[model samples]
Target chain A: MSTASVPLPNWITYGLMPLLNLLVAFFISGLVVWWIGENPLEALRLLIEGSLGRGDAIGFTLFYTTSFIFTGLSVAVAFHAGLFNIGSEGQAYLGGLGAALVALALDQYVPWYVTMPFAVMGAALFGAGWALIPAWLQAKRGSHIVITTIMFNFIGAALMVYLLVNVLIVPGKMAPETRTFLPGGQLPKLDWLMAWFGLKLGPAPFNVSFLIALVMAFLVWVLIWRTKLGYEMRTLGISPSAAVYAGIPYARTVIIAMLISGGLAGMMALNPVMGASARLQVEFVGGAGFVGIAVSLMGRSHPLGIVLAALLFGILYQGGADLSFEMPNITREMIVVIQGLVILFAGALEYMFRPTMVHIYQRFKRA
Target chain B: MDFFDIVVSILGSTIRLSIPLLFTALAGLFTERAGVFDIGLEGKMLAAAFASACVAYLTGNAWLGLCGGIAVSIIFSLIHGFASITNRGNQIVSGVALNFVAAGLTVVLGQAWFGQGGRTPQVSGDGRFTPIILPFADAMREVPVIGPLYANVISGNNILTYLAFLAVPITWWVLFRTRFGLRLRAVGENPGAVDTAGISVTWLRYRAVIAAGFLCGFAGAYLSIAQSAAFIKDMSAGKGYIALAALIFAKWKPVPVMFACLLFGFLDAFANFMQGKAVPGIGEVPVQIFQALPYILTCILLAGFIGVARPPKAGGVAYTKER
Candidate 1:
């Protein structure tokens, strides 16, 4: 990639390269499955059936996809500003507080439609507030954002535990969780939408947040490509020196990009807190924040690519839960291994096969 | 318990707890000093913990388990090297990927082999690193003041604790006194200069990473075999990050690394000491405060509130001939 001796077409660079990387990742993941004495093909089959075979499976898949989209967009926005916002997990965690507060306050007074916007704002504001210190550290203080964000993740986890155990836990309840949200705070399931496709929706948590995710994805595209701040962010990401030469304010762009990224991450809470459980549970973010990095990288930081990648992961997640039989060896955690492999090949070793591809292309052209 | 007993117990546990941080922070010291920023310490430590515990259970030999741990950790290091050093890809991205892989694969494999809810079987007999009672421990126990301290706080620790304390001085000696240390630090600060002097920058960085892996093996092995009985799920539990925090809090110095780890370890011991108990003046202290203390302190340090902690000049950047 650094050499760039042979210029490749956009189709090969964007399309073929990522697909090749993804295949290698899956192949390695298959090897792990086989190592654990499970049939890779059987695992794959179960995965597909469990995620997409039935209406309920699809609904669950879409539910997971909704969270992934928000997190993916969060990571993508940060990526555009040359920031690795690993604190999305923490941001999303805090976002839960904002959302739970909104639901707890308004479930009795207002309808779902009226409360949804305020919930969104609350979540985003809290999430952005979490990102503020890390962003300031990176933008103004020259601290490494990666280290700070990872630290904040632990801090956030600890803070949440304290809040849940000491403050939010309902009296007479053993569990460290808030009271379940009422009907007005709950997100309505997309049963009608599924019916439009002739699929009968079951007890899956897939809901209106999926629609919000889609709209947000489109808005992210607009924010990255069509806005002045987005252009400045791109300039800053590509080359800091170039951005400085262009007189783009580094601190302002970094802070703004991170705030937007954090807000997007915060929005991820809606899918789980409001849509799924309708309550803020301990550790509910559930590593969706990390899955976003893989989604963003695999998607090449484009919203369109992120959607497809998010769906692929949603399949893996939903299907993995249903994997069992003679070999229950491929646990839900096997999906995490797959995610890591995807990050390894697609994110870190992205151009591992490029040199060979270029060599083959040159020989073919010469012939 | 009396005040003396409480203080003695806390100090003893502090020594017990800081051993892992000592090994891991030293591990990170070597790697970061060589100009590669390694966030995958958590992953390597974790994988090593699983591997060592598995082998320890199978062979019933703690030494063999230690070997297994080191070998597995080194494998991870080489993978990181290939990705970040050879391919010149993003080091942080490679590290993040490895962390995820370790977090996932260890549990997946552990469950497959043992079927104990993502944990290895509890190892006993010679499979464990038993605490060694010192020569004077019995004799000194009856003496006043220094007696209890000598008997408990300083003595009766496992081999890893002794080795961990010894490592600080050895690390300081190796880093400041040796020619290889000079070259390693020089490579980190200015790889081009080291290259100009006819040293292979790639080889130096690789050696540093391998050293890190070897030390992290001890850290991981200490967690599973020395400190506890078995490899539980997520047992490393951010010790690696706290070690990283210790590194930054120490400003990457070896002697201060020891003190920093002790400070963090004392926080841990104190938290456990005060759990479910309230102080006279203050209310029940949430254990989470201690859990988050290292990270919060590191963040403050990194933010230049305490001091400017400058990394190796070329840290996290791959060395390129063209550059």
Candidate 2:
């Protein structure tokens, strides 16, 4: 029977549905755990404890959360302008390069406080630069943004490989990575932030970038909801025909939204390169861009939702790492499985349970 | 190696590499022509590769492995169908989810089953698709021109490679000549029209996606059982996306799809052949250029810099009868 004709409550749409989807995703993930002869309930306990039990674990979890927040916001921004950007992985890669260039030039001379702002701009610009062509193609040429973005991801990888191998490598080093950034380039740890809880923050790389991520989230919220440009973007996203009729300037809105998206994705590099590695390396983005898509979908493309969703993934990643250590049979890739299930249940089959829920809700109301 | 031998080797490698692309691109052609966009071909092929390798190692039969691969791929296709068709969800998001699931699930299952660091044990004997020597290949090897072309390029390939080539003409016939073809194409362009005409849009799309799964399964089986000895982590690499790019490059037609795969396969072969080799004037070009060529060319084609590559009108949209 046809369903979903009636509007459900906002509480159901935003809150109950997401919670149900997450539970289903976790349930299936537990099945995978069971298939490998592990106790799913025990595994869940270990996951929660490993990610949140200690100060260092919490720091690590929040560190991962920071990157996811950037990426999730990236996807959310583009999504608002009716673009599905799958190239944030590549953009983040380029963003790392942008961040590295700044860190490299200034680390020997200036303090990180002096280098931070420029590095942020550098990362965002590089990421946006990588996205420019796909955005331009989608805006002006009517090319499918998805395909172009996907292709650009490969091209960006190739370019990065070429640069790292041929140009950026230190003259005497064997590795493709650049030399380590000095103290000026390095982000100070948030150990103090952790110590305030009277717990030692051991080796976690939680740093100032988390704060930046929050600021970006707030900015994204403002851009999507408050500004005139955001209004045009939302207008274009909801209906291109309607936007055109309303004179929303489709090309400008699309390009600007993508730039913001790409820039946010690019800023994800700050957490890893400047905060953790203190140097740029290959594969630093490491599927965080893809995780962003999941975060955005799960969060319903809202900034507040994205922050929470990113935190959820951060817990999974940090906890999954611990689970792998405890149960060798389950690898770190288990987190990826959980991530996919979340996307499947929350993003695609979001309404699969909606009809059933609506039916039950209506039945209860009738009673 | 002599020039002729080099040509034969490169040509042989091109065909070998292109088979997966050929199969996968043709698979995409069907689903996309029926108006479903899938970015999960890579994941499907990777999952199927792992499944095929796992089954071949256990059953000691490549055919059984092939069946296993196809079965798993079909299951994924059904999932995609359930999401996009029945649930009326975002096709790209659904595809993205499937890709991740396949990628993560395969490696996880592989590690759990084999305990070889996410790699299946190498399959040999009947578990592998050994090349069948075409008649008179040794005799023809000594002859010039057509002899080496036929003996080396055409012959000495596994059964799946030959099937990949044959699928091209069959795909053309099925896509353009049959009643199902016309209806499928119509649905991709205007599902509403097809629905109004009393044809089931969902059923037709599901069939198209299943056909896609069937072909992608062959592609994955070829990758593990025919092309390689065992499953490797991320072994499909970006071939699925390359095949998707090729599908767009071919503009979703069967014959053109074959050519696009061949072109990409040749680019790959040529890149590997040219690695560490210096040109007379330009010096040694980086191999990444060749690696990136297919994507660059596809991007150019996509931007209407070359001939415009138009997708089906109703592509990427979930069709609802009520709408």
Candidate 3:
């Protein structure tokens, strides 16, 4: 599975390979749909229509894409520093707590503009704080980042449950959630954008946070490609011994990378808390953190690639819902199976067909 | 009411709760020893639980359901082996993807078959594992500590619980004493050496992974058929991760793994016990603290508080012949 065996063009390696993998994954998923007595082509059509055909559907797709973008960037940043931060889920959970605390304290006293910036900073800080311990341990204490992050995820979940149940719940409310934010704390949606363009977009949760996600993605690109720190990080990732020989501080690079990664993951809280829910809730992070890993892998840890991959997953989510609505046999969980197949092909078994593809290309070039 | 009764009841609950953990941790031990890092134990257990419950409901035979669970789990393990071993894929990504696949497929299949919100029909009578009481349990009722221990803490558990305990020692013996164990451990530590010695590293890893599948199958069957009557969505919860943590805490040893599972089990039981109880000084401690204890402890253990724990040398890296 070495890339040096047969040289491939950049476009074929980056573009055609992933597209082919995705096609094969979808083909297998179609078989699964067929097994359940549903038309795979119809299911796929419904999925596309449900996600992209209408303004409201597009809005929802982008809304989901926003969260994925944050988490995906989080994972991608860590990958550059040779770290696998599986704890983004935990970091995002704590980030929501940070945002919730800020909103809770100042929502009644301040305007949305003031509260929103503070909440975003608070989420990033909290998320970074949660990740710092694991990063430090990995850097200084030789702890495996993967195991520590996983442990932190469970710990974060337990901590959230305790806080929500015992302290954060509204008075006399049975549900384990904080009181809803005042109007001042709620983020304005992008409905104004549609209105300004004279497009009648239906009520959608797509908010200003989506714009924040775009800004963050662009910032990540600049951070990774246009900075000295990014050069050091990539060098450390490619070969640790060489980086050490060049006098790059391994520990500092690891911690800084994780902090930025954790901060990006933390920023994901803005989407659900300020934009959609307007309240702090349990399990709000939901599995977006885990999905980010797949997104990062599929995207090749590139910021532009991550956004595209996130949008693809966003389509799966919104369209999967529509699929279930149209076909009774194709339940929501079936879409997850499809997503898993995609992940399997694109991430884990990514190089399964590469050797054959490379061989064919080399032979065709000679001919 | 009394201290003795409390102790007995807590111990009983500990044994019950530790059953699934013990099975999973041991399952993880096999694969990890062979240098395959598997975080998919949770996914495998969930899939097996669903398969077992579905088969048990359909056939009304607990043993057959257990077999069905093992078969499904083995099939999944083979897929994992194919991806990670044969293709030399990223093990962690492969595991995460498998978890998602199992999580999704079980629900989709369960809904397609049972149509009961992704739950199989509840099995009763022979379809479920019944509690087995040891002989002379009635006569021992009048006796003291030993009697209570035997009757309350040890007896009346499903056969799987006993087998789970038995597996710990068996695993210890197999890992330490057998030729296969030597080859497995050697392969994990240095696959190149094993390859040079004319042993097939790939086959050894595959066998270890398949054995892990068998243990995970038992764990899953025990959850659905013995612990509960039917499979529920995400019933494995974080147990698979907990088992992975336990494996790390044990430093990949067999006996320590059992103890780690028991500690986690005791913590879980303690959490349940403190849910409504009030202490004189603290006054109704939050149950979440105790629930979170095992994970926190695992993190601390991994952070070099306990001496540095070393994994197999070639654990996460794919073995390339040229390299």
Candidate 4:
């Protein structure tokens, strides 16, 4: 009667499960396309060509990838600490506000060089501050981080909406957004380098901001693998009691991990403000913080993995816009379907394979 | 309206609002009491709402729609249970994944079904549940205080509301009075000890989760077919999450959970009422204040010490029996 004696299907478990998940996602998306009376394969072809084929599309994909990189790192950091920080969206919003304020306040007084660092730091600090309340509750009071973080996301959104509507209203403007940044506070473009590298063949948003994201990704990789602090944080993630037994300060480590994650989420403002829009725009993060959960899961919580995942997501996002324009009936939100599917497959990978994958990996190491 | 009449009106809305949450929180209570973390309640409710709304729209049969909703919700619950219990995956991740899947797949299917991008057709009132007036309450309106409140708040609610309120007594009887309930509690609190004592831990947990699935389906039906006549994307809107918070804030007791749901329901109703009313100093109170009240209260309750509420020791751990 014991089902434990039954062997698992190797092909279905290890090889075919991921393909099946992708097939399911595509089939569901195809159904949406079919309802709109479009050939699914042709629609997918348009989607691919629109996302990665041309120069303008490539630039746009890179532009979107910048935000994903920061947010993916944010979620990955929290994941390593066994903390699901669903409030990253809220933290990013607060961070955008912080960056805007810093840009405005020091616009006339300081040069671009001084203001840029301070603006980024201000955003990170505000984001960390926003996340600290929920982290403290989880660490000190044993509250469920999932519910508290989600609640905080709503609170953050409300706070931002209230501010944009009332206190932070731009003079002589009716829109629920902040005013444009001063000239000196705006991030400078790498147009000179793009021209030098012959990248001026088409519309390009590639700038120094992308380089900063790459650097940050590398830095995160180093921090997670090469440092004692990273070791303790990862230890706490697996088992806080065991980490405490190993002489790590569980409370301090948890709070620090959450704070750093929020800081990275806040850093996502660099993309929309410093890179693309060059001003404080409303909804600049554009759900990337929430979407970062998918990226983190797909990336297996590694920095390099996240960067690749971000690139793939960026292509999908940029291409989705084109597909929507061409098809008119199918919207860009179909990309969300793909993202959700990726998260499901990655999260449930262990379930599909059971103990076989781990056993196989162990056997390979013995050689 | 007189002051008493205003209080009676507020109580009436509170009961209507609390009904869905009561079902969800009681559903959470069963799963958690049997050591299964029911974070997927939101996903279950959402999927059920979609199923019920779609079926009702197609067939114009409300009862069949309700059954379809429960069946679909039970299917999702089985998936969740299999992953978390049998495969020993992380319960939180599995729940979150379920939420994402429900949200994504519902929208995908909704667009396919209605061709209007993630919304079902407006359901006529005929396909929805109507309030059943209690007989002989026609003359109870004349009595002062408790009588007026009872007639106003308790007499005219939908059948689901009555059933939701009735679930508390049933849950208490099953948990404390019945042997099956005792076995469930034992499995949740200490699966190993229960296993040693010759009870099937898996069966008890499965029954508990199945019961939760049924209750949550009712909650979803109340949302789509009773409270509103149409289904919208992400209509659950974190209410299932708030129900989980209520379950924790009430310390997992069925009676306390009912009161907790009422407290949240009252806050939501009051918030809705306050949107247009211009307070003296506030000058048309900001909508954000009302929108954030329930979440703010949940955060405060969770962060502050309100009598130590401990989860079962084996709550999130999966049981694997040795052969």
Candidate 5:
């Protein structure tokens, strides 16, 4: 049976269905929390307070949101082109390397403004360049994008480890990290904005990258919804054969879509390297690339939805840390379990309750 | 050591390293052959590893641990079948979700039950699988090349290693020879044809998934109890993805799958060997290059440089009869 048997209103389809699914997920997560002998509601309360209660907490949450936004947008763009770009993690890793190279080479000589723009360009170019091989393989060589991207991620990680340990380490340092960037290369934090508003703000990594992420989200919306290239990409996603029949060059669109997708994923490096850490750290991308997949799925591939979803995950990350700290028994892994539950209900089992809901709606309409 | 001795040692290491890949790739073979693309092999293996370790540690019985692993893996496989088959959901999305769930649940439960770094207590003696020496191992040691080969490479492996190799031929027979195998293969190729011929597509697919679960369980058990003696967090470590790559490299055939696993295993062993040793012209090539070789090779192979590899006709598509 098809899911379109009983038509529902836009409000119920978009808003209610997701809400119901989320409630079920949270309920199951609550049972798991209780299984570990902790009060789920109390745990959730602590999570909210930890993530959004104070200025610093909010700052940290926003900082994480910045990373997710870029990666989520990357996945979304690729999705619109009928490509599953799971290599965002690898692309972001290479992007960090690119940003680091530029900052390291020029930080002592140039000012922050000059270094930042060049660093951004380097990251985008490198990230896009890394993604190009997989795209070309998919477009021309008949390789599956998913498998190639996944393999590329491992290769990228190994390459980074080699470079960090043997080539880029500081002269006498033991740590597998690059030399810290000079103050001139560092992006300015948003503490000044808080001060101007006469608000007391703790030192947080929230910086100019957050603003850039927002701007990029808007740009993505315009590009995807309004441009000729966007139309072709969406058409290609919907029906490749039809798009080919309509004179849309399939290979060119695939390459362009992946380039844009990779560029966005690469931009994620700016958050940790330039905005937060001020140095190239190993595994700096963490699991943000994978999280982007969930965010993109939850947001239904819309820019606004992605922004909101990213913020939600930011809360989960920041708040989950606090929850685990408070309830030592509820370890960090439990939080991951909860997040996995959310992904399960939100993605795989998305239409689980749809048929029942649709039947109920039809009956109500008849009455 | 001489070149012959080095080759023997590397070959031994290759067999040891490839056991897990062999099991997982064969598991993927069964599921994919039945038209369900499962990328969650890593997660299932992880969960099974944890479950087996926990049970073995508690009961001090390796056999019981193997049973526990298989049971847990089957439970997960059924959940996957329910989502993709009954609910008609996207198979990839379901597999991915289950993977995340498995990853999360295993660690969470491990911490709750064991309370020691999310690791189960180390099992010793009866709880762990020790190496078994073959009957002719001692006698064959004096036969020059054959003696060293049998003693070094063939003998002294855990029972599961032999089971993994044995699975290759058995899987080949079951997939190509048996009536169930014929129906399973037909379902993957065209479920509608099977349905028209009076076969139940859902039941056949579910059975295929259950069989996959059993193989994955054995792979996980081999990791925790047989190979490592403890369940380390994230112990699978992308071996499932590598196994998937091997499955693709083998083009879904059982005999080629074993060979592909051996190739990957050799690459891994070579990487470990080259870590501190010096090469003639290269003069101690970086270890990372060898470590990255399998993935890089898989990418090149997948790029159609070797040949085009085609999946099952109905793979990854949810089958629903038109009303």
Candidate 6:
């Protein structure tokens, strides 16, 4: 650890640092669990079991990850367009409402397969519409998307609370939630198919939605890295003036990026409604969209990075509960502290340690 | 007195209600004009409220407690500005993190200090800042609209209320009539230009943030000592965000900003009035509906806009000078 010497490669700088940071995080957290009177090994055991233990745990974990993947992608896409879509939470709520309404309507009028896709499409439309307003304003008026999107989140939350507590309240229920989705509108399960294989013997709660998220994740990679549209989005994100010089339609690119972002966010509700719970409930999104910002940032706004980040977050979320049950007086809210710490470190990584590390590298190189 | 009496009372309540907002909004004007988005205003207010309430409860002196609250909030603001201006961290993330830290730490600290989870011990009446009855208020109570307006609306407020109102005109003069205010505004809009003109961007932003922290401290003290006797957890609620909105809706101008705070304050006062009263002729409105009027109006204002409002160009971006 010389003060100054070597020039570290960019690969090591970006790749190894994150891994090193996570290792350090786990080491500290492990000690924290120990101080609370819980065995570190046992806590680890429970964490693994809770996230990947058997059929049920796997199903729930995968379900949770699916929604996160979409929302993470939502944030990532907007990041590519140089905009921050903090309104993913609001957009997802609109998506949930849209999907729920479609599901309820089709319960009386249409077949299952036909209505299910319609439900998803309806949600996509509403979500896209929600994002376009801020997108348009950003392009035309130089308004910061960051603040506007946050404002939109507030508006969305109020709107959802009002609608759910009023008009969307299923005829007689006192709860502020909508009716359950029709069987036809639900996402199909592949549990029995997995049962044919020896791998399905566990408590994994994996479903078709998980696969849908993976497929979308893959598509996002291709669309972002390989396509011309992705190139335009990237250019615009990096420098709008440069993008204009390159003949890209800057405004159109911005609007389309937000629309895509919103559509992805809308798709997230599918996991909870169609796969996991099959019902529309208040606060159902459970801050998953907000968590998406952390995931996207941690992933460095790359599609592959986002997929892995979502899975990691999903595991921590599921495991946090199991640890709470095993260890008395230690609740799942502790996970929130860990999550916030992770965001703080990730967002301020360079500020936190880069100076010391780089100085040491410079000394080594000179020596 | 009849309708006129009721109207007079409403006017009085609105001014009293607007005091906290007026302070925070003016604080917002200072920081934002210097090109920093103080989304942490709500968090700062909450911290100040907690500190003031606890200190006043312990010391039995409201003035000392108020100063303590302001100092604590200024420290928090410096942390925010330090992280944002020096570290170049994301402003939105920093704001959110500060809010969360404030929310959690306040409760944890309050519980440890007072044995209550999210509340402090109430202070005695002698420890609370009560309004001083001035002859100016009594003498003007009889004049028609202007006299009643001055007496009912402006005269009968705690010491902090007078300071908050005075801040507006002073702020206006500073922003437009003074060198420091001009530099602050120039820094906020474009720090590079300010730096090119030989101004220290970081110093300007830090000062602006400190000023904001001091003002928010007053806002918080007003909430706890002047308005209420004890600090409640999450009492700031969304007032900070509301002030941010008011700042933007005012186009960051001092005079318009005052009107914006008054407007929001009136809506709040009206909500309180409608709680148990029936509309002159129509049946009574639901209390919940009245309670939600401000949030509903915020949503409408958000969705009703034709275009996005522009903030200072470098408002949230950190300025790093190349030596």
C-alpha root-mean-square deviation, each candidate:
1.2, 1.0, 1.4, 4.0, 1.6, 4.7
Q: Can you tell me which runs of candidate 1 are displaced by over 4 Å? A: A1-3, A324-326
lDDT of 5 by residue, B76-193 (tens): 8898898888777767767777787888888777777778767878988888888999999999999989999999899999999999999999999999999999999989999999
lDDT of 6: 0.77
DockQ of each: 0.72, 0.81, 0.73, 0.40, 0.64, 0.20
Q: Candidate 2, residues B95-198: lDDT per residue as tens digits?
A: 99999998888888888888887889999999999998999998987788889998888999999999999999999999899999999999999999999999
How close is every model to the real structure, measured as TM-score?
A: 0.98, 0.99, 0.98, 0.89, 0.97, 0.84
TM-score values for chain B across all models: 0.98, 0.99, 0.98, 0.93, 0.97, 0.91
Q: Which stretches of candidate 3 lie over 4 Å from their true place?
A: A1-4, A196-198
Q: In terms of docking quality, how is candidate 3 classified?
A: medium
B1-323 in candidate 3: lDDT tens per residue? 99898989999999999989999999999988898989789899999999999899899999999999999999889888988998888888888888989999998888777788788889999999999999987779779998889998888899999999999999998888999989999888999999999998899999999999999999999999999999998899889999998899898999999999999999999888878999999899988888888888888888879876888888877777753
Q: Candidate 3, residues A1-367: lDDT per residue as tens digits?
A: 5644767888988999888888988898889888877788988899999998888888888888999999999999999988999999999999999999999899999888899889989999999988999999999988889989998998999999889998899889999999999978888789877677565558768888888898999999998899999999899889988999999999999999999999999999999988899999999998899889978988999999999999999999889888788887778888678777877888878888888898889789989
> Which runs of model 4 end up more than 4 angstroms from their true locations?
A1-40, A108-113, A171-174, A183-185, A188-208, A273-284, A327-330, A354-367, B136-139, B142-151, B281-284, B320-323
Better of 4 and 5 by DockQ: 5
Task: List lDDT for all candidates, in order.
Answer: 0.92, 0.93, 0.90, 0.80, 0.88, 0.77
Model 4 error, position A162 (Å): 2.4
Interface RMSD of candidate 4, in Å, is 2.9
Docking quality class, candidate 1: medium
> Residue A190 of candidate 4: its Cα lDDT?
62
Give me the displacement of residue A56 in model 2, in angstroms: 1.4
Tens-place lDDT per residue, model 2, A1-367, is 4666877889999999999999999999999999988899998999999999998999999999999999999999999988999989999999999999999999999999999999999999999998899999999999999998889889988988889888999888988888899999988888888888887779999999999999999999998999999999998889999999998888988899999889999999999999999988888899999999999999999999999999999999999999889888988888989999999999999999988998988898899
Residue-level lDDT for A50 in candidate 3 = 92
**Candidate 4 local lDDT, A230-308, one digit each (tens):** 9998999899889999999978988999999998888788668765665666666778986788778767788987898
Error of 1 at A228 (Å): 0.8
For model 1, residues B1-323, the per-residue Cα lDDT tens digits are 89998899999999998988999999999989999989899999999999999999999999999999999999999989888888888888888899899999998999888888789999999999999999989999999999999999988999889999999999998899999999999988999999999999999999999999999999999999989989999899888889999999999899999999999999999999989999789989899998899899999999999979998899999888762
Ranking by TM-score: 2, 1, 3, 5, 4, 6
Rank candidates, lDDT, best first. 2, 1, 3, 5, 4, 6
Clashing pairs for predicted structure model 5, backbone only: none
